[model samples]
Target: MAEHPAYPVGLRLAGRRVVVLGGGQVAQRRLPALIAAGADIHLVSPQATPSVEAMADAGEIAWTRRPYEDGDLADAWYALIATSDQGANTAASAEAERHRVWCVRSDDADAATAWTPATGHSEGVTVAVLTTDARGRDPRHTAAIRDAVVEGLRDGTLVAPHHRTRTPGVALVGGGPGDPDLITVRGRRLLAEADVVIADRLGPRDLLAELPPHVEVIDAAKIPYGRYMAQEAINNALIEHAKQGKSVVRLKGGDPFVFGRGMEEAQALAEEGIACTVVPGISSSISVPGAAGIPVTHRGVAHEFTVVSGHVAPDDERSLVDWPSLARLTGTLVILMGVDKIGRIAETLVAHGKPADTPVALVQEGTTAAQRRVDATLATVAETVREQDVKPPAVIVVGEVVNVGVQSSPKTSE
Candidate 1:
């Protein structure tokens, strides 16, 4: 007769006793899972690694400070034997079997009744990959298969029908930087289900090209001019489509709230009695700099980073930016939409307390295939921008942190 399947069941060990033998590497790894299961864990070992010792100090687990014995299994609902000594493993398994408690043996799986599977957690789902082991699990080449499935799970590629339901509402999704793959899982899934997509100039345009032919794609860039007029039209379009009982996706570049005018749309929809949901995207202010191998904030060099818009020149009366205040800040300063006014912005910073020799970096078309970086100083950045012929949709970083991550020009800001 074949042994009963080791019952692939999840144990509610919470508030129940769980025993772990040996305080070495084996126990170190198993204890975390046991702890996560809310089990009352007992560690039986005279010596333990510093990490285990730290856990004990924090009262996360009970340390017996002695070797395992038969009595240890008396109250344990589950046990794991990870001692290097085979005799100790055998002894613990024997005790657990007599008590009808399942025990896992790290030294010899064939002799054990329970096996630990490779596990991963994504979203709200917990996945366990059981390779063919003594417990009749598949072990022959599951790594590649496991990775592919897990990737699909994370990117929402295997979204269910319910997830893509054609509900009448507006989903304001922030496409991270310019990478199609950087969009959030929920954002990508919503895009697939969108009846109409209102796309921004800097959004992940590549992803839009892959949308179904039936999906209506509205190019926000071509919308008529005047800032207020353009935004009002976008808002009206979202409300109009959603009211028509169709799902509308207001796709914007970077994060919707981070200078993307997302809140304005949300407020507009609310006043119109239309349902609106927000799906935040990865902001280029941080990710763009990172892709260029520059740390916006580093330990000793820069403790903070400030992201602001340079679309309005500092000399312009309409510009609300306090250039003097920004210049006084010793931390990194990141400017978005500032390519057109970089000369004035740099000049203002220098005229203020900021050093003329401060390292400056202009990253154009950041986080995209055409991404390019040109290094200069605050004093000569305008000339560099002209020399490099840099254009809009760029990120300007001014600080010492840029120097730490990558090699900067010996050129002075003066």
Candidate 2:
């Protein structure tokens, strides 16, 4: 039989009782939204999945631990009938109907008084898609539409800039180990909304191409071993653009705070009374070795991992790292910006208590194309680097953990 089209509406279930007649996959999937809405949820089920039981244990919901009863829907503002027992679901639906509470049935949508739409959230906006037919509902189609809308909104393609409240500020966004897909969702969304981007030489460079034509992408002149004046210039540029009421993003490689001088930029902005939002990216210290199939820490291998910058030579007074203490430890050591100083670092460790034959791996351009791994020992790493002609922006992993999970062949990347 033909039926009227389903009407769409948002439910404000805060501080209201919502009864759920199942604790299986359906309830497990839908309960989070209800809980997030501040609903007083009561779940009735004789058995529940471990995740649902965890919710009950966490006191997020009240679990009856029994099958549906006649008065279970009493005083319920909303009801979800998803019990495996069809008779129990039917009885619960009938009770919800008698009480005039809207109910959704999992097994029998035809008897449902309400339909749940496929929903997605982006930038404080909720996108919900629903399609009803006399034959059947196409959940996959609705989900695809919902995904498309959310993606468009998140990437700024569907955004109406005129309707948005533009607040000019600086966002120190971590671009994450040179991979375009590795950046955080918030960071990507902010980049999409940016009016001007002051980007570093490293990081996800491909994303800059996707920015709208109106966005001014500035290649920040941050030369390796450059004087402090270069950083000062970048800071001045950020402040200047933000003062002009333009939303600016300082996109950097890996995490902003992890040897990226992000705190300096944030401090600079703070002194100017400008708002700065820091979005963390995946640090290459851990991610690089992992990408090359080397776990920084492994069971029964290395118990701890230490990350330190190799920007300054061990003999250099500017170096803050305690090389002697690191050499004494048996844990894994992940070095960033240390490709040039690997020979000095290796000699220092070997001169200390560290073994000369300790396994080491250099992961260059990790988590992206042109990535490669070079394996060597502590005594031979300096020579191996020279032989291999490895460059900067490489992560040097030291310790036996480099040998664990060794799936990638030497000098090759997938």
Candidate 3:
């Protein structure tokens, strides 16, 4: 047990030497945090785990590829002794003590000059917990407390109403394909902090139901064709709400930049001098195909893949996609917002020399309980959609790669 209470201090180790004496699981678990702190990490180990080796290969740390020697901690500001050899750890700890560098011993907590508290980050705050009772140190209890605090802060359950710094800005967050759980941690936390959330019809709709009652949810569902005018209104709404000092979040489906016109909103905010944050979401172009058990690019089957927005027909004057070139490539083609124009797209592809028998898969409402997959070839896709009543918001994958993992998951097609 520690003789006295541990004095917790945040060390700014950026550009300072931090020596790690091992590359085992303990070192692997702790090195990432040190690296994130911008420490000049020097790792000394005879051999390392694959993950640790990868870090070395990536040049995040300098590995000596040898056991810890007496003078390894010569110029280190901080040292962590996690070697399997107790003798080596003891010697390294003594060397750190000589150098006046704080040392943490994974093998012996009581012998450690410093303790690594269970730490977690939420928003901009870091929560660290170290529990040392009369019995001894309880790492599990400390970790549990850290988790509870971080979770509370993330979900806004432990809000400090008066102490909170509410900065009004526009956050363009990606809600991910459909599942509320698929949204990123930062995206969800921003949602919990938002005062007004302008949402789309296609995103993780269930997340809106989880928001606090005070949050105003504006439906920014841009219906086909005519809703272009509504986009101006939505942009104005974002600008107006932000100018009024309200935390506004423009929650989009998939990634905001992926055909979601996220730049337009950002430019509007920039012109008005409002702060904007872009939180990328999991795009359905790649995710939807995988959720339906289809790999976008499979070995030997496909070496490349293309994501195309098919909202405009192939022959439309406004169409920017080169359909002839796309059909000529022997790779995967994933089309978004193309369910309505599937027939014309299929016809165009077949006419441009693509084989009619090339396998095609359509994933609808992906990554959700309502998700389903519809299978068809270029020749039959148009007819299949008609017979099955396939609707919008479906991803159309075209290529031989669609057949590779098609049988891995069961498809619920109505």
Candidate 4:
């Protein structure tokens, strides 16, 4: 018998019992939504994906650490049967039927009483698409449609009433390394809604071009580059624009707080009683290395990592970083703006205590199409830098962690 067309309605599952019968990809994909819905998720599975295991370890959800029992879903308001085993899915569905709980089957959507929809969210709206005969057709079409709608919503091409509230204020946005797609959902929305965007040279410049024509673009690079003078001018700009009832977005390359001068701008705004919000970006200190296949913090190999600016040389009075202490630590050393000073920095580290042959990976223009990776050791980093003609706006990683992720690194995977 064919199932009746399912009625679409939002479930009030907040703080309610929800039982999940698998820990595979399906469960992993659905768990984030369930967790966000405030459901008390009970995951039953003998094995789990690494990410799910980490979540369980973090106490984000309850893990049974075994196969589902007869009464696992007895009091569950909702049950998701998503194991790879056909028999297990059938068994869990039967149990859910007996318990009068709605079951969502991942393996066979038709076998279960409930169906999951292709969902997309932007701003404050969530779009869910459900086809009556989804199994008979290609799911890619539905996904494509969902993505198109979400993109339209994101770019402000498709406007929904009451979907977003635009309050004029300053948003310190970190555009994330270099990828235009890497900007946070909130950051993108804020950018689309921005009346004035003050962007840095290193930020995702492509995104600024996508903004509406009415939006004013301020080049932060044009600002005077004095320790106090540069920042003071930018602050005044944010306050003045926002005071004019214009939504100002102070867009930076990486994380606004990690040498991006975001908090300082926020402080400046607060002093003038202007409303400001901080939207964090993926910092190049960690992300740039990852783009070059290097994890800043690898398990067991690197217990910690330090990110420091190389904008100033070691001999400069303005430099406050303790090079000797940094060289002594047994973790990753990620240096930004160090291309010009790479030779000097390497000399100082080697002179202090760091190994002359320590593994180094310099990722230039990370996460972008122009990205390039140059590998070397402390003793030969300067030579490699010169050989590759590596330039500024690159990440220089110094440690064993660089060896763990890259294929050529001497270290083995954990």
Name the lDDT value of residue 268 in candidate 2: 97
Better of 2 and 4 by lDDT: 2
- Most lDDT-accurate candidate: 2
Q: Could you tell which candidate, 3 or 4, scores higher by TM-score?
A: 3
Runs of candidate 2 with Cα error greater than 4 angstroms are: 222-225, 407-414
Candidate 2 residue-wise lDDT, 313-353, digit = tens = 99999999999999998989999989999999999999998
Candidate 3 wrong stretches, greater than 4 Å:
1-7, 49-65, 74-76, 95-100, 134-138, 157-165, 222-225, 410-414
Cα lDDT listed for each candidate: 0.84, 0.90, 0.89, 0.87
Clash count for each candidate, listed in order shown: 4, 0, 0, 0
TM-scores vs. true structure, each candidate: 0.82, 0.96, 0.90, 0.76
Clashing pairs in 4: none
- RMSD (Cα, Å) for all candidates, in order, is 4.0, 1.9, 2.7, 5.1
Best by TM-score: 2
Lowest summed lDDT across 10 adjacent residues in model 3 is found at 405-414
In candidate 2, what residue range of length 10 has the lowest lDDT sum?
A: 405-414
Q: What is the C-alpha local distance difference test score of candidate 1?
A: 0.84
Model 2, residue 298: distance off in Å is 1.2
Task: Output candidate 3 Cα RMSD.
Answer: 2.7
Candidates sorted on lDDT, descending: 2, 3, 4, 1
Question: Model 2: which residue pairs collide?
Answer: none
**Residue by residue across 1-414, what tens digits does model 1's lDDT show?**
124444466778999998889999888887888888899988989999998888899898999988777778997888889887788788889988899888888887777777776666655566676654344656445555666666666654554444555558899999999989899878887887688999999999999887778899999878896788999999888888899988899999999999999999999999988889999999999998887878899888898899999989999998988899999998999999999898899999999878999998888888888888888999999999998898878888999988975754333111
Q: Which portions of model 4 miss their true places by more than 4 Å? A: 1-4, 15-32, 39-113, 132-140, 151-165, 225-227, 294-303, 355-361, 373-390, 400-414
lDDT of 4 by residue, 138-170 (tens): 578878888989987886666553455667789
